[model samples]
Target: MSSPWFGSQRSQSMTEFALVAPILLLMLFGIIDFGRLLYIYGTLVEAANEGARVSIKASSPLPSNSDVENAAKNGAQSLYLANPCPNGPLPPTSGAGAQNPPGDQGWIFITEPNPPTTVETSPTYDAPGGQSPASATGSCSAINPFQSGTYPLQVTVRYNYLFFTPLLEQLAPSIILQAYATDYTEY
Candidate 1:
């Protein structure tokens, strides 16, 4: 009789573990996914900075430089994603990294002073990086053509994250991470 009771207790423990394990695993994946998203976001920001620096490399090139853009894209490829940006992917128009797919491109946002217009950019990222990637024009101080001569350039890169758990999916159908870095260019 004691043997049967002990066996029943052990079975109950296993049942409890089975019930709790999935939730715990899900939580663990959620934590990992979130951490990865943050890391990717930072990487994108760095990539943008690299790209923005490209414009200032030679004090501006004619009609923008595609090689400069590729340098930015290559910098981002270091953190290459298995499931690149699904929200939007912009292809390299020209330069070294032109062979890369649209999903692996870095986007540029140029706002010239006084009614800024987009100088060069991808199809999906025609807008500037605002307060947040999604914000409009970043609530930025109005551009002054008389005072500031430099063109404000922002590089925005996107990354698509594949989630292992459903928790993250509930937040969004597909996790598209974005990073932006802004710089001033005389050109």
Candidate 2:
């Protein structure tokens, strides 16, 4: 009896552990990766919301494209406890003066005047070949669109999130998040 108990049982248990160890490790890694992904998503949402809130401020004239970029960077840093923008800075604001147009930029939006419409033509810029000529440009209106209570403030944020875990990186190299909000400014 003693010989029977010792001969095969110990080896069987060892074999079971050997068979299960890798699976267990992979499961643990999966859980960790999922949690990290969730955290990143939450952080991105908060950052976008923060950016939108900052954009609706009429009193301060809303942040410039650079300012919005900084706001996003700060928001992400605060939420993630790490800097998300390592390539010098987050994308410049989307409005004029930005290195890249807002639509093309990675993050940030400003309430600059929409491009002007020509009296000679219907609002056609939305269609192909509708872009105004370079000489057709005019200074942005001094009038705040929100003054008449018709145009509400708009906030938009774009974020590029990088995974902190190697496992997640291998699965989904990176993630992009976008958020938008609309609210009237008191000013």
Q: Which lDDT tens digits does candidate 1 get at residues 93-124?
A: 34653323233333433333222232122222
Root-mean-square deviation (CA) per prediction? 10.8, 10.0
Model 2, residue 173: distance off in Å is: 3.8
Tens-digit lDDT track for model 2 on 35-137? 8657656665666566545544554443343444456557666442222221112243345543322221244433322323122122211111111222211
Best by TM-score: 1
- What are the lDDT figures for the candidates, one per model? 0.48, 0.44
- The total of clashing pairs for model 1 equals 2
TM-score of each predicted structure versus truth = 0.57, 0.53
Which regions of candidate 2 fall more than 4 Å away from where they truly are? 4-8, 60-62, 78-150, 160-171
lDDT of 1 at 55: 47
- Model 1 regions more than 4 Å off: 1-8, 59-63, 79-149, 160-162
Q: lDDT score, residue 136, model 1? A: 28
